[model samples]
Target: MECNKHNQPLSLYCPSHLMPSCDVCISTSHSKCNGITSLASVVEKTKIENSKESVEKDINYFLSILDQLVTSKSKNIKTGENHCIGVKKSINEIRKEINKHLDHLEEKLCQETDIIWNQEKSKATDFISEIEGKRENLKEMKEHLQTVTTNTSKLQSFLGVHKIEQQVHQCQRYIEDLENDERTKEVDIKMKQNDEIENIIGKLVSIESVGEVSVVKTEINLNKETSLRRKAQVKSQEQSNINNMTMNIETKIKINIDKTIRDMICLIDGRFIVVDWHGKVNLLSSDGKLQKQLPIPGDAYSVTQINEDTIAITYPKERAIKIFNMENETVMKVIKLGKLCNGLSFSNNSLAVGLRKEEIRIIDLEGNTLKSIQVQSESYLYNLVYCDKRVIFSDSRGKAVYCVDDSGKQIWQYKQDLMGPEGLCIDTYGNIIVVDFNSQRIMVISKDGQDSKVLISKEEGLVFPQCICFNHNESSGFICDYYGTYLAKFNLSFG
Candidate 1:
């Protein structure tokens, strides 16, 4: 019962940390925490009849869930094994008809089948092992639960119940993650043999195997409980607004290529079409690695995804937009704009271009003008995004962000604590996330453009962050530094 550090007998419980702390601990580390009292007082205040029963009930509930997950994942392993066996049988049947010529082909197909099946099997085994580990954690706490309850000591029961309850919540989040994960679903092994291969094999001397083998992943929702749970979670967030949302940095990639990234767009397929102010247009992988670089050799300012197979990049110096086929990285057509384009955004088959003047041009992919929105600011550079029938643009010279309608009217403006604003984006919940060049931070402004919070700052290692974009699914986002060699990928989560 002595203090761990100051050697003062542990006399107080910190409900925030779910622990018993000495006086010295509370004065410093636990200063901001509330509800500090003697451990015995916690049980008295909460009016608990049986903390043991309450916590044990939660443990049992989670253990049942873990048991279900173990059974389901094991079944997927069995299903994949049976599927692979069936595929191998077909390969052998072809071998019987084609004789020894098909022997090598059959062996190769079976080996390929084993490889694919084993990969899935390993995934299931690993998942089951992890679930079992969680199960063991609950079981250990259950054993300790008896020790705490045996003496009828309020201090022991209070602390035990608190720790075990925290474990229950951890287990709940883990189960929720399993429900969202694709690996929890059934993994189907598909190896189709070409009938022509068996028929023409005897006629021809040699050929390239029977058919291609692949692991076909199904999109079926594995857990209905999870599906409904996710819907409820999303609905709960929808009840509020993005003002209640926040972000956590998930991944960081140091761009190996030396290019100044001005703006970037995340596509539906997790790829990025990024533009460099230094005359380079590159296709980047989800991790910010350079995949392919277009040979435009012009000072590109911004890029946007126009369609699944097309992208448009604006070269301010050239005063033109290049519509290129993303498949081949070749220019399909050129849409010449007489004004300098600083940023581009596409929605509803229309393009919104930010020019050097106080106008925002709405154009189509075929270079037809749709609508031009007029604003009060005549800034030289404007970076903008179009979403929900509103054009959210950043005026670099004004050091502010503005929301406008298509009919040349202003909606709202955000102009506080902003320093050298550049690229901005509207998140799924209509919150505007913008990166600042001079402030070296990122901010999340409310949809009404009234309230804003600094989501990240230079204290968080941001060095002139210029562009910020969220993925289509809203699960992840990326921030590009103005220097172009560093990108921060963040996980987007909402209450």
Candidate 2:
């Protein structure tokens, strides 16, 4: 291979610079460089002799780990299915209660209305009969008067006329008495219209939705006992030889800021960026001393290192991701997106964005959309980490952790006793560390999905843990105690 800089064949290796040098390049530039060695010698020393055997052993080890994870996840899937059946049964029970109550109301209302209609009909029928009787009496009096006037002599007619007149007067008096009675004046029953009652009936027994129902593989343990329990179980199966191993924690810096801390990211230069609930990003030294604070245009929820001197932050409210250049301490560029940016992770020269509705949009550094990934979840995806060509995301509403491939296929999910998983990070050991806000604990899970453990808890004074990050070497880590108004630092003692 020719050296791109010198345009000549590589001839020697320089240990000081850790790169291959050409003859002309070494003579002119690397002549004073220390630890110069031949390229053949360096290659022979670093190359493995039994590469085939080593590959087989590595393959078997990884395959065994994969088998264990598959078994565990299969059990979780069964549990999730059972939980779904239980939820459906519960919903049916509630529906039965609602139907029973409404049916009773309908029966009672029908009976009451029937009684009212019968009473009103009886009053109407009685009024009609009384009017008919009066008409028949009047007809009889008119016929008798006509017979007396036509068939009798003058004197006889005079006597009969008086009697007929008396009869007519009587009939007239009866008719006037009927008119004077209030009950005779158009007796009828009617129901008055009531809009309020109609409105109430329409609103009663209506279906109201609470939230979405989705089946997810939830955690086996819900509190800070996950790690301890798993560790005890593993330790019980074997004997330990190492001694004097202890994990120690300390209060690194307690900055009493009134603002709520959303997330914190550790930089390679021993500085940390603390994002708050508001639009402020605070830069602090590794010792927790305040250095400078930058104000973003919108609420900043996530911060991640893009390169050695540049960091990317998620501005969900503005639907944009801004690149913050650390050297200038200013926003260098803004990648405007059609969807809102929530969780963010930069890897393989691409940015995996956790958008709304549990979707991850993969975009290049230039803000062009490469692909969109929809996670197998109904809840929103929160903080995420990109490591080893995979995206590890936390679902705050679902209370689970999900890992997905580049093509948006879910590999496996881990959930147990997790309340609200927010920010996640991959440690040097390839273990996933999650900060759960609702449970106020930090959980660590192996990348293979076989084991999980709790690193810190509320008992350790971690109140409302938001974000967790490891330093460059992963020997030490930092936790943002959001509501506690402090930062917790812990040292890892690997046994």
| Residue 285 accuracy (lDDT) in model 2 | 83
Tens digits of per-residue lDDT, candidate 2, 152-218, equal 7999999988987887788778778877876666645555556545534533422123235754555
Candidate 2 has a TM-score of 0.52
Please give, for residues 1-495, the per-residue lDDT of candidate 1 as tens digits. 977788898888998888888889999889999878897687567746566677777677668777877887798899999999988998888777767656888898899899999989999999889879999998987887778767777887798888888888888898898888987898888867674554354324222355334465554343434211334433322233665677788778898655556678788788876776455777888777889887765777678887788888887767888887877768888888897677788888888888765568989888898897766553544478888778988876678888888887777888999887888887777888888888888888888777888777789887878788887576678888776788889876776
Model 2 ranges off by over 4 Å: 1-247
Model 1 scores what on Cα lDDT?
0.77
TM values, all candidates: 0.50, 0.52
Which residue ranges in model 1 land beyond 4 Å of their true spot?
A: 1-240
Minimum summed lDDT over a 10-residue window in model 1 is located at: 226-235
